[model samples]
Target chain A: SQQGEEDPQALSIQEGENATMNCSYKTSINNLQWYRQNSGRGLVHLILIRSNEREKHSGRLRVTLDTSKKSSSLLITASRAADTASYFCATITSYGKLTFGQGTILTVHP
Target chain B: DVKVTQSSRYLVKRTGEKVFLECVQDMDHENMFWYRQDPGLGLRLIYFSYDVKMKEKGDIPEGYSVSREKKERFSLILESASTNQTSMYLCASRAGRRALWGQPQHFGDGTRLSIL
Candidate 1:
């Protein structure tokens, strides 16, 4: 069973614009992580937000987690064509099992 | 940098044939995982190992089995390859330390398996 579900299965935005993707999970989590994957490639870790943390930033990426709401959001500022890829949110269950969401395909047009 | 290498980037096999998908991590991490990715189902875990010779089944372990003979090597075995087993296989590793939940998993390039 999938633990997380991402909204807006796909998103299209122009370069220099901000893109936001939301994810909601079913159960409590120890931490939430965001990853990016190019077509036909493995995933690359982007950022991680612990249950206690509400928000985190890494370069041009921002991640926010709301434990009470069991939701998280990823924001990419100043999107670039190279950022065109699928973004996924993974949640670590209390038992240590990691579950991933369906993912959000973001297209950044240059 | 941590390097998790999958044995093959692409593989073609026939149904009922036994297949082996190997993964090796150079970081000496103690945690290794195998997952399969489908179009809309996302990535589903097949199995995971926390240490050498210690294995656990994941969400989707029905048609898959995993082996962890060495600390750095993890292998996924298809006892009897089937058409439905064709998908993108991903291997990931992470440090097995305190607060393992806080660390991120490093993934390999993945293997696109096609079973006929």
Candidate 2:
């Protein structure tokens, strides 16, 4: 069974707007990480929030983790057309395995 | 920069043929993993190796095997290729020892395999 499920299978937003994607996992995890995949490219790590951390920021990206709810959200501020990609949330198990979500397709139209 | 390289961007094989997909990492990462991606199914891990000559089964390991002869290289093998096994295979490597799963993974571009 998949551990993480991403909400909003697809999302469309205009440039300079904010984009938020949510992910919910079904198990206890040490941490949650977000990754982006461009067309025909491999996944690139974006941001990671630890279990004990509530919020983290990296440049225009903000990540919020709610361990109590077993969910996390990634926020991209002032989105651009280059931000168009498939975003996935991954949950790490105790055994060092990562289970990825179905992913959210975000298209930032310029 | 960390770079995980897959041997092929695309591959085609006939059913019942033996197939091998190779991956190499340049960051000297201690962990390597193999996954297959399909539409709506997401990426399902097939196998992972935490060290040289060590391997473990992942979520869906049926009909698949792995070999990690060296620390920087990991290989996934299909004993007998089948049509249903066709998918986009991705290779990832993380710079962590066993049980240190918080680190981010670097991925290869992936190999689109077709089993005819």
Candidate 3:
């Protein structure tokens, strides 16, 4: 079963604009993480936000978690063509299982 | 920096043939995992190991078995490769002991398996 579901399966934006993706999970999570995958490559870790943390940031990435709602959102500021790829939200179980979402394909037009 | 390496980026196998996919990590991390990704359905876990000689079944493990004979290497075995088993296989490692959560996982480039 999928633990997380990402909204807006595909998004197209121009460079220098902001892109936001939302994710919702079914069960409680120990932590939630965001990852970026270039074409035909492995995913690269972006940021990790614990259940207790409502918001966290790393460079151009911002992650906000709402435990009460079982949802999270990722915000990428000043998008670039380099950021054109699939973004995934993974929910970590207490037992260390990482279940990834369907992913949102973001295309940034330069 | 932690590095996870998959044995192959592409593989082709015939139905009923036994196949093996291997992954290695250089960080000596205690946690390793195997997952398969398909379109419309995200990445689904197949197996995981917390330490050498230890294996645990993930959500989908019916057609797969895992081997963890050494600390740095984890292998996924397809007892009898099937058409449905063709997908992108990913291996990931985390820096946690005893299967604790909260740390980010490092992933290999992935193996795109095609079973005929």
Instruction: Give the Å error, residue A97, model 1.
Output: 2.6
Predictions in order: lDDT: 0.93, 0.94, 0.93
Top candidate on DockQ is: 2
| Superposed Cα RMSD, model 3 | 1.2
Can you write out model 3's per-residue Cα lDDT over B1-116, one digit (the tens) per residue?
99999999999999999999999999989899999989899888999998899999998999999999999999999999999999999999987664456789999999999999
TM-score for predicted model 2 compared with the true structure: 0.97
Over the stretch A4-104, how does candidate 2's per-residue lDDT look in tens digits?
99998999999999999999999888889999999888999999898999999999999999999999999999999999999999998755788999999
Q: Write the per-residue lDDT of candidate 1 for residues A42-70, one digit (tens) a residue.
A: 99999999899999999999999989999
For candidate 2 chain B, the 10 contiguous residues with the lowest summed lDDT are: B95-104
Which 10 consecutive positions of candidate 3 chain B have the poorest summed lDDT?
A: B94-103
TM-score of chain B of each: 0.98, 0.97, 0.97
Query: B12 in model 1: Cα distance from truth in Å?
Result: 0.5
Candidates, DockQ? 0.71, 0.86, 0.86
Pairwise DockQ winner, candidates 1 and 3: 3
Q: Candidate 3: which stretches are off by over 4 Å?
A: B98-100
Looking only at chain B, model 1 earns a TM-score of 0.98
Off by over 4 Å in 2: none
lDDT string, candidate 2, B1-116, tens digits: 99999999999999999999999999999999999999999999999988899898999999999999999999999999999999999999997765566888899999999999
**Which residue pairs show backbone clashes in model 3?**
none
